[model samples]
Target: NRRGLPEGHADVKRMMTVPIMRNDEIVAIVGVGNKAFDYEAEELEVFARYADSVWDSIQVKRVEDALWQSREIYRAVVENSTDSIVRCDVNGKFLFGNEAAIKLLGGAEAAPIGKTPEELGFCPAFRHTWDASLQYVVAQGFPASFEFDMEIAGRTQTLDMRFAPEYSPTGRVVSVLGVARDITERKIAERELARREEQYRVLTETMKDVVWVLDIESSKFRYVSPSVYALRGYTSEEVVALPVDHAMTPEDRAALKALTLDRVAEFESGSLAADHFYVDQFPQPCKDGSVVWTEVVSNYYINPDNQRLELRGVTRDITERRQAEVALRQARDTLEQRVEERTRDLTRVNAELAAAMQVKDEFLSVMSHELRTPLNAILIMSQVMLEGVRGSLNERQLRAMQTITESGQHLLAMINDILDITSVQAGTVVLDRALHEVDALCAPLIDRLRAEAATRSQSIDYVCPSEPLYLWADGRRFGQIVRHLLENAMKFTPDGGQISLFVQPDLDRRVLSVRIEDNGIGIAHDAIERIFQPFTQADSALSRQFGGSGIGLTLVRHLVELHGGTITAESAGMPGSGSRFTVQLPWQAPPVGSPHGAILAAGAVHGPHVVLIADDNPSAQRVMGDALRAAGYEVLAALDGIEAVATARLRPPDLILMDMQMPRCDGATAIRRLRQLPACAATPIVAMSSVVVPNDRALCLDAGADDYLAKPISADTVVDVVARHLAPGRSLIDAASGADARPS
Candidate 1:
């Protein structure tokens, strides 16, 4: 008999004895050397049965031991795995937990065992899943896997959990084994991929050019951007299912196929890549049965896996650009045509201006020659009559001759207007300044126009400042402005109308303001602004009714502006109403070094003083000298400044009226010479000239004369100036009027 011992045990060193039993017969007994305890009969009987029974029982026990060892190894592996391992009862309470599960829970290893999921901070996201998973495990007794998000230990975690049911002998689930893995990072990666995909989709939709990808083997489109809908009216999905050639026109499709094949062959052969192909006018059919132009560019893309090639590229709609090019070409042609037309028009206009200028020059020449000749003849004839060379005339005849002379003067004024207008148009109006008394400059003009006003039964009231008003100005032009404005007022006014003139100093503005107001046929409101334009009348009827050239106000405005002043006309806008014209001129004080000899000389000449007059025209001389003599002054006569000077020297006359433009010595030179003599130096000498321009008076006065006078001087004006200079302290006329008139 053999004893069963543990596997790989060493053999016993001493032999031992045992009894054997066979078929109800006693077997031989064997004696052992020694034993620790006596073998009893009952123990031997148990051993005797095991000789057969013991061997079989030993084999069964050995099988049971191997199975238990394998189970232990599997249990250790499950307990030590990185993944959390757990076993739960049917009620979802934790029945067992490995070290991983305990560590994952971040607490003591003994804490989780026998605890419910709720006690360990495990709550199901959906309550229904708990009941379903429980029911499934109980009914099926099988393993199942599920995904869930759970909050564990104050943090959210994604879990992939597998539940395996533990069954009893009756096939009922006693508990469940669960294996769980944290999959939070995996879920985050999946979400990030989805977000990027959405971004790409949005970018493709908003882009202008069509983007597409093709499957090389199938020769069909796999991807198409949403922009294809805008360019070709084909939805992305529709284009993606169709071959690329289907979208192109037949001609373009053929060309594209050839090019694609060539590129594919080159790529497969490992040769140089075929050149990238571009077609600007590739035709595409729209959903509306219309054709559109597209620009296509493509290259061959070799598929790495199977060595297949695909044509992938973009297509842009070029219809608008093409239309713009066509329109631009047409515009270029139109611009060229317009440029030629303008050139021709300008050439014609230039020729017309040249012709007009030539005609203007010819007209001015003829007008000057014709007007001057007549004016010269009339002037000469008037001088001859006034000189007594044509014999003495009666009062009536003298008056008639005076009328003739005045008419000639008026004609000469018209001629001057013509000449001035021509010169102004030719751009030749220049400023020439001289110092003179404003009142004296305006006095002769006022006297001449007075008679004209009287003829119309009108009266003019003139007022000047009490103090002498001196100004540096162009005297002739200054007089012209006054004359034109005065004449304009008198002509428009009806008989019995009143005209008033005034001069005042404007100290703040440093200007002299001269105003002339009249009761007349006033200008209309619309006509006032245009009245100063040359040749412009208030109305065509005004030209006929007033008998004016309409250039008077225009010339007045120009002359006033030339002196750095402005003139304006204001009217009541009705016939027989009133109009006022105001002129403002810049004023400069006279130099202190200038002589006031004229003022001193006027003081020397007392009442009834002898005054000698020298003028080539006898009428002027007589009228002047007689006016002086009549006003109580003794008068002497001479033909010119030379004769006047000589006569004054001979008779020791108190004053001399010298004609400025004389044959021998001019008044300016004569006065200069006479001033050198002590006897004449203190004498009052007045120089007269017809051309009373600004410099003329200054030239005379600068040469030592007492005062300068402009011709056709009136009797009152000549007497007034002469008297003022003769006796500065006395009444102006007191010097002219002898004792026959009272001093007052």
Candidate 2:
């Protein structure tokens, strides 16, 4: 009472004070004064009860005000949300939806009350899903979320939706609240990503090389290609499930892992660029429990989504290469020791051997460069004239050119035979193996040879399998081998003789036999044994008459052998009975993307196409330029490096054909300068070199040439190379008339 009304009253009539208590705690004092009648105990008690009631009313009003403010805050949040928000009654009917939800639903400000998702014309599947989720929330008295697709507008849209039950005072569920988000774009991106991953998986499975992705930290394969099976008889699925170092010897595995970890650390710390891929070799564990040497090339990359470093790599069986290297070393050591043993008596032999080697080296260099360069020009220019890409020619001239072409081709064949023999002797040539389709190869070859056969008065017949045949081999060498057999048949078959070719696969044996038979001058029965011997002919008289190097069959045999196949000759030894050469090659499907190594198609491109040819040889320049002009490209000829640099600077051409061996600075040097200039940095520059050596190619590439071509480049090669380099997103290739071999 002392604490009531501040103890200051001016009226001094009557006063009453009551304590406002909540849960038996004094919250405040309620007081009233200036009563006219005297107050008794009963009246005071009544006044106290009235005061408690009044306090209860005030608390109730305060609670109502707080609730209204909280609702206003919620409304503000809902209106401004980018996601669609909706409120629904217990019967799965929409109570209300935000502006975003209305816009998403594509309506003109219509009330959403009493409308179900089905009534709103949502897809039935999605509506059913929503109804099920809402029912679950209502039943469980909790929240639920799901992702589903709906066609609100014309296009389908993906949405993430969540439903939460709203309960009444009695804990009865009355309504539901939902938040929906339009994730259509995100869903589309996810599908696209899945498609690409599936595409990658297909490509990986088709590869001949063991391609894999590794989680570096876990040392486990995240992905692997089917080539693992071919390499060591392990399925792609099996390999991926194995540890990263599953195929290495324990010692090699430990060492390699350490090395790999160090490299990974460098990659993560920014010391090494992701662009660089490193190579490592170690022994691999085969599914058969055998160990084979493998060469692994790997690059570090950061997976964007997970931000984890990953290793993408390809592995190849390198046991043969390693063995070859060791054999070479042993041979060298033996030769050195033998020389030392015969040191006193071998002075004359050593001098003779050195002189012989020098002569051989000079011959090879001239044959590849000096000899082939001029021949390339002649054959290309002749071919262009024959094709009528140049002006028309009379019959006599055309026939003469045809004679010239045949002669040049003969000379080229002779040159190639020598090259192959040399490579075999030196052991320098290795197979650039790839996949090829048998039909695709044979069709073009037969078409090409038919014209020559017709001229020779030889009628040809060919039989192929009903189904498409695919095999793994060096397409160029395979084509070459087949062409040789056919050419031999065509050459020997007398005028009006029939040459028949047969291709059939032995499915059970997994081998394919290409049988070529000619009803021409057959081998003598006595001399059949010497027919395939190198540099030997069936008969001296027949050799003179047929006009052949006699080594064609020898080279063919070698090529077949290199491809791990066999060749056999059958003849009745009666002249005019013809001969049969059957090459039985093992059946293997070439890796994916391998057939492309042999074929190139340059689609029509819009262009006032400019091609710049930089060569010191005027004849070579003339040859390539004419070919370019024929292929719808404007030609720019540069005689030397200086001129090439100047012309490129004056007007940047779409492509540059840089000759590596040039006066006053070579093509490599010029390429370096041209690449330094921004205009030519990305311009395709194919380095042409008469050196025909691996080192020369390495030098050209190191100097920034986009591609490299050895000498003996022909018109078709020139045209093809230009088209290949100019074609959208195609790699450069060799200009040789042989196999359209891609640049290594």
Candidate 3:
């Protein structure tokens, strides 16, 4: 019945039966109708042969189908797994691309299939690998696998490709199969890790520090950087073979072992940090067998597999830095010590300066008082003699009296200089304010010195401006300054030398310049700077020839400065040249109700009564004493402090006459001591000294003396001082009393 089916149905059944092969065998059969038309004998024979051949082909295909299924399962399992998979043909053409590969390529498997390695942009190494795989597969007829680098879509990729040869039953080549995995990420990670390891190795090798790894359990070197050779004179290989403990001396080894064991225990107990310390583990011996100092930082690492601890450490030679640190510390200490020493020295200097200043003040005070006392006696006695209080004298006696007067005046001038210098040095000079007409103030001084100048055959020319120059200043001090400059010029100038004085306004600076120029011995270049210093002469010979204390210019400079002015000297060096002195004074107008009228009124008086006498020599004292006794009233004698105090106490004298120096006590000390006594305290003390400083008069006043008068007492000074200090009635009475007084 199955054979009687229609021809169409029979073909249909055949088609279904071919597909029904399972497990490589057919379990049942399906029948179809016979051919529609009756077959001839030839046709029937052809059909039977075809049917037999078809059945054989179906059975062979069944085996092939089973193998193909098995292969599909294997492929699915391999490809669907998380691993990347690919397959290529002998020519390196993609035969299959798995899910992982498709995902890596960001596409479906069909996109990569049928593409050659070149088309897929595989790198040369991959292409070569593929070719080698193909060659090996062809030769051995077996599978092969290799790692390769490929460039896919401009990105490099790493792949592990496996090749398998498909062989026929005779073992002849048929086709080749390849499985590829995209191991790009894994390869990259591996390469990065290797690179990091190489970098670490290079860093360690190049470092100045020594790096080491040791096996804790055995105390043996696991690794050491090449620099260990430089540090400890041991190669890495040699060190690795020996126990780390063996490299250390016995004492150091014991210490290291103890320290390492402790650290390992602490690490196991979770009590030790990554950082630990070890002392002198690796000592580098120098050429001379001396050891260099080193410091080590050690840490522990536990191996994951073995649970063994490794001691990894770095050793640094800190000798140089440490030495530098020591040196810096030493320098700091030294600097601090020097600062302390300097501070101490400065403190001592300050103390000494303070003491010196104190001593200076005391000395000035004492000197002023003592010198004034002697000057008073000389001045008073000189006045009495000039008044002709005794019987009329001969021409010789009158001439001698005149000499005494002149000498007394000279000595008084010297004492005044000393006081001025003392005051200037002590910074105590004061300006007495008054209205002064420049020409009028200078007139008297010029007239007085005119005769002296004429005696030298020198001409003093006064050039006054048409308009009067009136200023507010100390008139006496200003006159003194002008006179000093003029006198200086006169002394230096030879006979017939021309001296000129003139006043002019300095338009730019609003000042008045008083210039005195003379055809005199010019100052040398070397002496110019020192000329203004007190007691400094230009040259020793000049000092001797000039007969000056060298304080005139200094006093002039001080007075000018006090008046807010400046004075300067100019000369064309040496003989045959002339000298010029220019004084510049700030212009200040006099007050509306100034004392100019009073000064003129006072000038009208022919003389002053107050007397001051100062002398250092004893013979000058007797001569002065005899003159003063013949004149009138009480006389006080002070040989020294003792005599001065006794005489002053016996009678409170109108004025004190002082000597600068005396036996038993110096004049300065004597004056100070006398000033302390009550009786003589109020009396006017006058300073007299051979040695005169620029500020001596001021110094005398500062020590409580009233005025200054110099040595070699004169009759006129005595008469002048008595007239100045006495009441008008007393002065009149003394003038009359002079006729009755007897010569001593």
Best by lDDT: 2
Candidate lDDT scores, in order, read 0.75, 0.79, 0.69
Cα lDDT tens digits for candidate 1, 1-744: 365857896555444456654577754554443345666777666655656565557669999999999999989898778888888889887777778778766568449777765676555553356547766876787889887676666778787888999988987789888898889999999999999998988877899998777876787897888898887787989888887677877767878778767666777786654665545466798767678888877666666767667667778889998789889999999998999999899889988977987798788788778888988898889878977898998888888788889878878888788777666666578655544588988899999899889988999989998777666567888988888888888988899999998988775555688999998888899999999998889899978887878788888887876665788889879877798999988653323443444422332343235677877888787567545543445567888667866776777766778888888777777888778777788888887878857688787778887777777778879878876776643232332222122221
Residue-pair clashes per candidate: 6, 3, 58
Among all candidates shown, the one with the greatest TM-score: 1
> lDDT score of model 1?
0.75
Ranking by TM-score: 1, 3, 2
lDDT tens digits, residue span 469-528, model 2: 655567888888989899888888878889888998875554688999988878887787
TM-score of each: 0.48, 0.41, 0.41
RMSD of each: 25.0, 24.6, 22.7
Q: Where is model 3 more than 4 Å wrong at Cα?
A: 1-84, 89-93, 99-126, 165-175, 185-199, 213-222, 236-289, 295-314, 318-744
CA deviation > 4 Å runs, candidate 1: 1-88, 94-125, 133-223, 226-325, 383-389, 393-403, 422-486, 493-519, 554-744
